[model samples]
Target chain A: MLALRLSRVAHPAVQLRRLAVAAASAGTGFLLLCTFGYALGEPEHSGAAVLRLSWCAVPLAATVYLALAVARTDPGTRPRPGLSALGLGPGRMMAVSAATTALACSLGSLGALLLFVQLRGGLRALPLDGGAARVLAAGRPLPVPATLTLLVLVPVVASVAVALSLRPRDPRRPAAGRGYGRFGAYGTAGARETFGAYGRFGARLRSGTGPQAPAAAEGARPASGAAGGRTAVAVPAGPAPGTATVSGPADALAPADGPADTDREDADGPADAEGLGSEADPHRPPAPRKPPAGLPWGVAVLAAGLAVEAYTSRAVTLSGPALSGTRTGSGPALPGGLDVGSVPVLVGWLLTTFGLALAGPGLTHLCGRLLQAVRPGPLRLLAGRALMEEAGRIGRPLGVVCAVLSGTFALLVLGRGPASALGPLTALGTLVVLGCTVGTLLTAAVEARQDRSATTAALVRIGAPGTTLRTAAGLRAAALLVLFGPLTLVVAYLSALPLAP
Target chain B: MVAPPDNDVLWARALHFTHNDGSPALSGVSLGVRQGEILAVGGPSGSGKTTLLRCLSGLVPAQRGEVWFNSTPVHTMGPLARERMRRDRFGWIDPVPALVPELNVWENTALPLMLRGTSRRRARTAAQEWLERLDVGELTRRRPHQLRQAERQRVCIARALAPAPTVLFADEPTAPLHRADRAHVLRTLTTAARSHGITVVLATHDAETAALADRTVPLLDGRCVRTVHLPPVQDTEGRAACSLSV
Candidate 1:
């Protein structure tokens, strides 16, 4: 009830975010219920119905994940500093967040139920519309138990996900500032140390006490107070053996041997990465190192997928000599079917998609490097850097979208017609899945943009012109399209080729 | 160091600011800065150093104060005018780098120039020069996440200096750097400001940083309690050294 009240009184932006989550849930729920209704209609093909319903779960799951992300970043829902003093601790705040998420999803599920029941006719009878009766067990009664089960699925999954993602870490640390529970930079060295790499994924996301800049690094020079009057300026250490002093200031900060002057690895790359020595080392100077070339794991997975597809494309064809006296009852095997079986083909497609997804971040990083390899202008530099920074955030979503497109393309090729062979219900299911996945990816991008807002604001304050930022954003989009657009087309075409008649 | 001239580039009188929560951030604070002069605002945390800097730079208008930038009344200017002034005449460096994580050191440094509609080639060239001047030229290809704290702060200083703003507002710009790097960056900043004739309003807690300034104003509880002037130090050649690397 408190969650619902808070939703009512929350900032418009927070409310809007929740509304989107609710809407997505409604769409997912509608799809799931439709699948369940179809199952009721076709009790004879109950196995197929179950499979279709399971497919519906994919989009529903994506929606839940997005909803959880939104909740984590919602400013109105975040616990403020001093709230714990009022007896609302981190533990209580987390519960509030989870409850709020559950309420939003439950609302969406209810919307889906109402819409489904209305579209199918009324609650009085199972109203199958648009000749769905022909494909389903048309005259059969709708099973209440089955329908209720499907309706509750979204809320249950979403709430549990919210609970798991938002559980409190250490209660001792005060809930302080912005960027807590946020997906990008935690901003505080303390928070970064406590949460480690897991914080970036919205896991153990800690809110800050306020919008204060993070305190300086631990064990460094202690900050001089007002009483430390007129302290002498620190003298620059002599340059290492071979280095020459340029301008006094520049010479002072210059690393004698490059970025390796310090033993501290914490400041090296991303907080999560240990050694990316070749790429970021300032001492190496000129020649760009080659990107890691071995993709043996991807290759092995791709080969396995190809073998599966090939076997499935043709039936079990047995040689007469090999089966001479082996089977008396079942003599010779003529090519059994066009493909080994739909199940094996599906599994192959899944493996191929997973391999591609795994390879996405590395490929994106390479694309970033390529952008700056030439005579990079300001736009190219900005775009390239952004791609490198956000490769992890956006890569998986891009991969998922690519996989869906490729799978749809292959299926279309196998059918060899503009008319979808999967039929209307199946087509609708696929659409929901693809659409929700893309939406989830877009939400991630939004979160990333939010993470960069402070930097943007700082730039603006310093008199950075607006066009520079806009151009940078445009360049990023363009570069991503240029790189991924072709890859998607090629993967779709190749995957579809094997099944072509 | 050159003696401060009589003419003031920026002057603020009787400034007052109250937060939305009713906490006073600045209370009747007043000061003046000469062109090419480096003025330091030294205080403890919450002593209103940052608030004073923001008010004088036209980032936040004080509810009760008169701010003049070379005879133009800054406090009375509209939002667009203030923004235009910031874009064209002023540069700011925060305590933290606050660099755009997606941008490399050069691109981040050149951002203000690019935003001002300078050609891509020109902006990048200017950015590269500043990066070299700050000794971070080799890391031009590196993004913020790829840099150490000191390297990142150097890039921030380069970005602020590249545009050659009339006045620069730097709030504890050396907070993140190690002791050695801190002196170097401060020297670079003071040298650039002097060479370029850019007025500097620096806010810091470090006495070393303030000692390099032409004058230091101590703020306490959002009010200026006192001002101190330091005698310029002379190098072996008998030239007055205004730099922090004494």
Candidate 2:
């Protein structure tokens, strides 16, 4: 039944769901860590310490759970049977997971700090010298209550914030145009426009439309009217240069027009020849051509700048004063303060963080440029077609496998804990995943509907017959998979949770 | 000797046409261009004259109907096989610039051969010979953008003929050229196909341009209205007018 379900689901959505599940699992893992920490050594009776730990743990947990839920609800499923798994590569999955974890941890920490500060302020009213610390540490049976409270609150705040912030915006909403008041909206629109432009450029390259113009100009007669000169060549009605066109063996032999001929032919076409020359002005300039395929220099410059900064920062740290001994200045410096001893570690961390931050954008940009340079012809068309088909086939099965694994892991973890723990954890995971899946599906459905509308507009412009029904069907299947899969898993988990004796 | 019905047929079986925007450009418009025959479709703008060529070559989708190659439907085949069919069965040259401008004359001419999975070295060698035959050998190393108008036309013609497709569709091939260049391009196209035993379909609005084809069919709106046969022209030496009929 698991295999059957997996077979029906698309791959990318499943992978996305798995990622969400993994995030939630990480939160569970963090909880396990805290529980184990408490079991190992109970901290002294200090309210501040207990508050700090709880604040940290709570947010981490919340972020992970929320992320998982969000992932579960991603409403983008396609019936890609065999190659669905390829949609979310292992590397991409790991990266997304790591980033989500870090973000959750950071947010949780901030929330915990805020609560710690608030509690400290309230505790100041007490008579104790270290009132803030004592109150945090105060709790029956080894101050576990305070610690648990901090752990739970920290993750909850962080998770809630992240869930709200990262929620995918409705794609159909009319994006705000440029201006200061609408800066956020405009930024999103700009990013979308850039993405669309890049996609179009890539498509043009894949289609072989960019590089062929120059070649076409050479063979045909000049566009300028010359009496008794070589006749202008007519444009052929076949595939554009550099564009992918499906054709049988017969298409390989047609005569193509040169640039000069193409221009002349356009001039002679019935639209131009009707001497509607007023509307069909022969001298009308062609649309501005986009830049040829190559890497934009700005990215390279930015990369170089980052590299220089990284090197200089590392060098400065290495050459700075040693701090093995006590500081000459007022009172002994804090143990964790920046010093020569910690310089190497700090440098390494900085380097790693900077490298990680730049890797995806740099690589993607470079690859896009490279792909552009390599003109698409017969080979690219064949490869692209094959890849798309294969991806469509494999995308769904992988998602199901991942989901099953996640479910099994959750069950194992729940079983290992006390009965009291099992009920809450199971319920929490199930509800989170279900809610996220539904939200994601709703978002995706709305977006798909908008896409269908856009496609309709484009078709109308070209006077072509639309395929709304087919597109709608595809989107519907996607929405169902995204929404139902997590809901089912959550229900199953809740049902299977061992009841308290 | 008359060719077999199947041999004369350029594309066997049905046809399908689909545009990118989830729209049907030519909804299963199918017809055949036989060996030694010229087939024409005349239509108003947007009647899908250019689209028909795209469908025949698999650039567009049929959405329905089988696009057969030698009686085998190409629509049912895999992408690689379909590409191979495009490379080896029919030569296509669109009205727009189709030659890779970055590539020199030889590279552009040998594209089809290269696409057929031919080795680069071998393809270039064959391309060189074709350029020579097309009388554009002097421009072999020149990029397409650097060549003159007439030179570019000849180079495209050379590229199309190099792979020797069974049938060729020239969509408004004479539309861009002046009277003189137009005549020269048409003459070159027809004569070259005749020698290679390739069928040609030249879609044009000009009546004079249609007269250049062995047979012309008027396409009004989206339907075929009439078919006309033109008188034969003299051979290379102007020795005699050959009687050509399809």
Candidate 3:
């Protein structure tokens, strides 16, 4: 199974691209850290500092690449480039994701062990006492055992747990409606019926009333009358089946049956009719057309959010002070040594903040596009429907993942002593992330439902049928499932990652 | 042969229809189709035969009077209910191939069944049987675009019959065939529909084809003026031969 999954991942061109990008980023970071070490006057522990910087580059590269991959992946269709295309059941996909995460954690732990070994050598070279050597050695053993255990067990346990516990049910089977019980008001068949009714009414209003007539009259009349009263000659017939012929004067007289009574009412009616015919036919005027509908709210919201994030990230540059520290930046300042001027810090902050802000609107736009592809409609409502439908499909799994990861990270960070003071702050940040996700999903749902209802009502007035309405609903539902599922997963993972807090 | 008595209540009153450009396509057309009878409507190109069929099916609106489908005012019914009525009761065949191109012949045939929520396997089995009956079972796996004109027509016919609709409105169903194929098609349609007690309302310009019907009504400029009835031919048994007319 491991080989099969890995092979699937290998097939994507994205994997190679990711590896290349990670290598480049780490190489650049290593070079910069080496420059800084040399400029700092080659301290006794300079080699250790260089090793620590190099070790840190690995996770930085991995995190950056993963963020880019997740952000760029379109949620509504086939997996993005570089993702395994093994046709793994949803269950298998979940397992694969878990395995990937565990692998990353193990790699990070190994890098940390290398950093500890280098730091220990540097400490011994600094002429520290025998006690310090013993402490450094003891600390060196600590990270090694942890790193070894993590490398072996993390992926295995995560893969097995995910495969067993979160295996996706067959999509063809009916899914249990989230947040609603079996007989709940929201997801019952009756709701479908109501929506169906609204959709049918809308389609009828759109088709209009001008075209339908008995086949006999439509086929027979043109050849027999008017247009210089030409003799009704039959056209060369094709060979399919069932043919008939029609006569001319009969068609002219058919519509004007009450002309006799009208003639009696006005002595000049016949002459008037003759004069009218000579003056150009008036029976064929065109009908007026309807106006187009306006844009949907969901689309508007998404656009606005994207604009805000773009503006804000560029506007605020965190610099100029260290908030009463020992110096400008000695010792682990700001909880995680995250220098504001550092490219990684700036980039990580920008992505995390901007991505969170854009999440709702992005989801809406994605959903809308998916719906439009399946069934043509206004973009705004399509987006709204997409957002709602997707949220429902992915909400539970995402919530569970967020809760578990945040809890685990909190436990690990708290166990690091002195960092325990920041535990509550991290918990608060996790809450904020979860709250944003839930809020975005709920907003999308409400907007989509509203748009569908409005469109259906409009179609009914114009004379559309139930089938059209049902089709629209189905389109909305499918769009939602496609656009929001992966997005929710990404959000959950991001929310659980260790931040400055 | 004696003429069948005319039923005034069954006749549809004259009505006018306008297009989107302030021009009228159909002007005051009137006609009637009785039970167990075939009504033929023939005209030149752009004579509004297709429009007339749309009006009959409640797909298009009429400017005047009521359209009675088994005595129900079709125009007054809600769009949803009207659509349901159309799907359940009327089988419409358009001149253009109307099958969804993505679906194969068997899938297209079983579409109505699937729409009605039948299990896919059962619906497909039924579709297979229907295709065999139409002598097109060999082409069941092919998509509509992959089939020849005649094969496509057969698949369409199979789709129409799959639902066993009350009335089948065919618009120039034979317009794409050759001479020999046309006669065979006409014979097959008439024979098959007769066996199923289906009323066929066909629009065509061929008098020879009209002669095959039990009764032929002529439509001139969107109006039905006269009707012709043909006697049932005697069979070898000579026991008042059965005629499939309506």
User: Each candidate's lDDT (Cα)?
Assistant: 0.68, 0.45, 0.47
Q: DockQ for the candidate 3 complex?
A: 0.02
Clashes of each: 11, 105, 54
Best by lDDT: 1
Local distance difference test, candidate 1 = 0.68
Candidate 1 has a TM-score of 0.66
Ranked candidates (lDDT, high to low): 1, 3, 2
Distance from true position, residue B206, model 3, in Å?
Answer: 4.9
Ten contiguous residues with the weakest lDDT in model 2 chain A? A244-253
lDDT of 1 by residue, B1-246 (tens): 122235989888889999889999999997888888999999989989998988988888879978888888898898778988998899899887777765657878887887777887899999999999888888786657556667888888899889899999999998766789899889989998888888999999999999999999999889998654456764555335544563
TM-score of chain B of 3: 0.82
lDDT of 2 at A427: 48
For DockQ, the strongest prediction is 1
Model 3 regions lying over 4 Å from their true place: A1-483, A490-500, B1-10, B117-122, B176-186, B205-216, B225-246
Q: Chain B vs. true chain B: TM-score for each candidate?
A: 0.88, 0.77, 0.82
Q: Which residue ranges in model 2 land beyond 4 Å of their true spot?
A: A1-501, B1-7, B11-31, B58-69, B73-81, B100-104, B133-136, B142-156, B174-184, B227-246
Q: Write the per-residue lDDT of candidate 3 for residues A407-430, one digit (tens) a residue.
A: 335334533422344432234333
